[model samples]
Target: MSIPSKEFTGRHMLMTTVAFFTVVIGVNVTMALYASSSWSGLVVENTYVASQEFNRKAAEAKTMAASGVVGKLSFLHGAIHYDIRNRDGSPAAVDEVAANFKRPVGDHEDFHVAFAKVSEGRFEATHRLTSGDWIVEIVSRRDGKVVMHEADRIDTGGSGQ
Candidate 1:
């Protein structure tokens, strides 16, 4: 005697469709939660306030760029180093140097490092950043006024060196 097989029916079809949609919807919800929790997507807290200062900040940036002050940054031995020069290739005279390190898409690893003068036009900060991509903002100040402001993107290789 042969065992009989059950025939496929509309109830089976309906259950299959429901199961497929449930899995799809569940995966989409999980992905959405992960994306939302990962990054806040906030560039500036107040757009209106930022807009009000846009022109002045732009003018200052233009002036800073026109001054031809250049900064070279490097990571060595788990330390941050910055070298600054003027248009004439001589050391730029600034009283203080500070750096803001930020992740490309998140703020969890963001930090501020105050650099000390190691030598003429040279500043050093003993901060070991994790090996990854970073956005660096270097600000040099003279007599309580910002003299040079530079932004650069850098990758700390696998060794974080």
Candidate 2:
């Protein structure tokens, strides 16, 4: 005996079209929800105020750069360290070293740490970071004026160092 094959009909086409659109719409909704729940991408709270101070901030940054002061930031044994140096590779004089740690996507997990002097141009903080990406802004001040400001992106691997 021979077996008869099933025939393709309008009902099958309608079901196929509905399934395809359902899958597409489901994926799009999921992606949109994730995107909206993640980062807000806000650099500053008030853009107009920031714009007003832009020229003065730019001038200050230029002066800081011209001062030939640079800083190296590192993490070791769960401690945060910063080394400040002058153009001649000598230790730069800084009274206080403060670090602001922020996540790239969110304000949660953001923190501030003050560093103590370990030696000339070397400062260390006893805060441990969780293993992830971080944006660290190191600011060195002398006589209540910022002498060096550096921003860097760091990835702490599974070690959290």
Candidate 3:
């Protein structure tokens, strides 16, 4: 049997070291790219319209608030209202407000889902509406906190308040 030369053994060791360094450098670069692309905290700020620069977003909050809608729409300045009603233009229950918005707006059919609750003689839903046409449907609250549910929706269109 023939034995390999010391030179051959030394060259193999050198190649192995190079391969290890290459892999380590590749992994470090990949990690840096991933870290830069992905953020770990809140991506947007939720401010009331009083501090907004865009007039459109502030207006949308008022329109939805008139209907007693709730959900995250597009918050502009913070003047929200709700004007929810029934098919016969009457009041609905807390579990029947499903607002389907299909207007001259986005390319896709974006909707606003609402669930009303009685506060005095008025009704309030769980969908914050924008300044558009929405067919709100009411839903019931389960064994979860309302805060865990839809707290509010923002109006990303115009400022009405």
Q: Please name the candidate that would achieve the greatest lDDT relative to the true structure.
A: 1
- Candidate 2 has an lDDT of 0.88
Tens digits of lDDT, candidate 2, 57-154: 88988988898998998888888889999999999998999999998777888999999999989999998799988888888999998889877888
lDDT of model 2 at position 51: 97
Q: Model 2: residues >4 Å from true position, as ranges?
A: 1-42
C-alpha TM-score for every candidate:
0.71, 0.71, 0.27
Clashes of each: 0, 0, 48
TM-score of 1: 0.71
Sum up the clashes in candidate 1: 0
lDDT of 1 by residue, 14-127 (tens): 999999999999999999999888864447779999999999989988998899999999888888889999999999898999999998777989999999999879999998
Query: What's the true lDDT of residue 62 in model 3?
Result: 58
Each candidate: what lDDT? 0.89, 0.88, 0.43
The better candidate by lDDT, 2 or 3, is: 2
Ranked by TM-score from best down, the candidates are: 2, 1, 3
